[model samples]
Target: MISLSLPSPAPPSFKPPNPNPKPHKPKTLKPSSSNPLHNRPIHHLDQAQLNKAISTLDLMSHHNSAADLLTYSLLLKSCIRFRNFELGKLLHKKLTNSGLELDSVLLNSLITLYSKSGDPVTASLVFEEMGERKRDLVSWSSLISCYANNDMEFEAIVKFIDMIELGFCPNEYSFCAVIKACSVKENVWIGKIILGFVIKSGFFDTDVCVGCALIDMFVNGGCDLESAKKVFDKMPERNAVTWTLMITRYMQMGQASDALELFLDMVVGGNAPDQFTFSGVISACAKLGMLSLGKQLHSQVIRLGLVSDVCVGCSLIDMYAKCMVDGTMVDSRRVFDGMSEHNVMSWTAIITGYVGTGGCDKEAIELFSEMICGQTIPNHFTFSAVLKACTNLSDLCLGEQVYTHAVKLGLASVNCVGNSLVSMYARCGWMENARKAFDILFEKNLVSYNAIVDGYAKNLDSDEAFKLYGQIEDTGFEVDIFTFASLLSGAASIGAIGVGTSKQLFKCLMK
Candidate 1:
């Protein structure tokens, strides 16, 4: 016994157990279907997991009623989240057939799904069905918001009025929707009424959304700068949107100095200008023809990493084009060539810049041709600019080609494009062609008629020109001073002045 004890003590001092140990059996994670913990739907899952769950659910046989309503609702929500309209519709039909349509949460989810699907018709139908049952503010707001977001502002405003008539006091979201609709309409009177309601309802002081919308309403309502300033001044807090809207208001009013002052105020107030802010200020500079200010803003834009922004870059080009100094076209071309991504506005800006600087007609024509060859669809403004270039270059051939293009594109009827085409042909001494264009126009405005008449007069076709002047008078158009002057000059050149024509010319001069 003594020897055994001595050996045990010596062994304990000299040896350690085996360094490597066997891993415990991973407790054979029980099958999810069998384990209560695993059977429950995962909570706080990320977007990916939720998506995966939706896919898995979709893979399951449609006959599986074992999938609860909550699971279906969650899948529908995920479909909305991912904007998978087809899957959303499928889930929605299933939920409806399952008699869960009356479920307030499920119904709300369906409304949201339809809204996100861009099928506002279906959303409206669902909303109507909800009205036949128990309804809540969420239901009303969802339908109203869908209408507003989809640019059915008139419908949304009407619905808001209906909602109020139904005795439902609008929440902040409802007010925001109504205000946004008013803003879209540019109805300052309606906006003021809405603002009063917002204030009397005490929503403006508490809700940032209402405040923001109020600001937008004033600014977009044709430079209600005073009201905009009032809203801005009264707000206890202002975000980037508020500041941007104020800056934009000034810019839109052609008040560049005011815009710059506001920009400086924003800086002093510690609000960093975003791309929109910079774009607005740059536009103000463009309107004012302030190249120096535009350049300074451009430098700030580079520092703010917004130089590449399409809108800001376009504004910068426009600003340079509007400068009184020489080399504006060079600066505009430089900006245009430097752009990495080109959209219609990018090309349009450069073309407009060329048009602004006299005798860039060739460059403008080349750019328009390039744009067409690149398969970029030209808009009405594009056609107008190209026609102007044709006029400047006296390229009757090019003008006819552009006219054909405009007719094919169904843009020939647009007043501005039509006017430009008439002027183009007139300037090129193509009076007959100008007359043809005028006749084809659906409705001739004073400008179009005047352009054709002026063209004939300039070409010394006094007979044709006088006939057009009589036609203009017969069409209930009051000839302006320019028209009278043109007619007088044509009569003087052809020695065909009549007493009637002389009296009309005198009256026009008096006018």
Candidate 2:
């Protein structure tokens, strides 16, 4: 028993005796022989150790002695570092009651603690309490960052402008926060205006972080991609995040070739691509069906020891499946099997690859079963893929069972799952059940109509097939090659190809 003077712990909702309580004199204590923590520096302790120290302080009575502002500030820093919101709130209550003055440093720490805890309201309260004279650059910057992180973009931007109006020079962190706010608000005008300030501040060329934020502002605000590229190209220094953003944006814009080219440039620049970059570039390889280049990237993936990442594993599976060499899916399976664990995305990717690759229906179904037995919940895409396997194998019983499982999971009415259900039932000669599934769909797409029309045509139901064909235009979907093929096949089977049918067929051929 060693006892240190400190405020006794109180509930989060406890109010102090008054707004400005009289300060208590703090008496320094020497190391106690009984408590090991008495000798240890508070700032050097990890979060768990700091928590134990706080617990020891909490047991002391308010009348025993009081901790100085520095000790309280150090405890607040630990709370923010560990994101221990409860402890921080308790400490806040104690600090307010301890009669220690709240300085700029402690107030900034409170703002950050509340901000990181997703309590922007409390952070705002703390900022307001700092008063105009005591608020420093760090206080304003922390508050702006708090608003930006909590989706209060408008407030962040306002605070930023206020900071500038108050004769405070905006720093790199300040510009990044405001720019992110503008990006989220989609206020391209404000974002461009801020870009000029960024140029004036000289952070655009020197600070990689500020440049990345500008690029993100332009790209995500739906502004011109050219502007984003111009900013990216002009940046004197770029980090891995910078390269990854450009690569990802290129892939999204369907410029896979440009993305791949940029990736080579990135490698040449000596900035090693992270797992995210690898995933994007590998997907670009899949999109272009570049088997040889994909293999090279795969080698890099293995060398960098990123082969076990779920995202990388999924991309590799997709790339191998799409860029198949000799029409075999051995590589995809190898990657999937090599992963240490499987998440929903990884399982879905492998199953989708199997379903897309021909003659692997049984393997896809088995994998689906394994996924289910492993207690991994399957999403709508998983159900859609497994149901397609049932359609390919014409296993009506298995399809019905899977359908039951989907219904139990409350995903039966999802568009993708419903479309697959219709296709599965119709292909297995269950037209009534297929129509039932089709009618239950919450939102029908062109694919759903195509599946039902093709099923009727294949089953020799020319009347229903023609009826559905006439309604395609009414549903705002253009008739495609699949629609024409189904109609022609139906007419040919029933000897119903008349002048009108011939004219339509000719029109389809012309298109």
CA lDDT of each candidate? Answer: 0.76, 0.84
Taking the tens digit of each residue's C-alpha lDDT, what string does model 1 give over 1-511? 0010000111123323653366554332122354332233333233246545544543343436244566676667777887778867876665655554357777888888887777789889888887646667888888888887787888888888888888999999889877877885456677788888999999878887788788777777545778778878888677677888778877777778888788778776777777788888888888877777778777777766678889988998888888848654888888888888888888888898898788888989899989989888888888888889988888888888998998899998998799998898788877777878788888788988889888888888877887887788788988887787778778788777778768766765674
Global local distance difference test of model 2: 0.84
Per-residue accuracy of model 2 over 409-482 as CA lDDT, tens digit each: 99988999999999998898889988888887899888999999999998999789878877777888877889
Best by lDDT: 2
Off by over 4 Å in 1: 1-122, 132-134, 146-155, 184-187, 219-223, 373-375, 400-416, 429-511
Q: CA lDDT of 467 in candidate 2?
A: 85
After superposition, candidate 2 runs with Cα above 4 Å error = 1-44, 47-54, 60-100, 326-328, 341-345, 358-511
Pairs that collide in candidate 1 are none
CA RMSD for every model? 15.2, 12.8
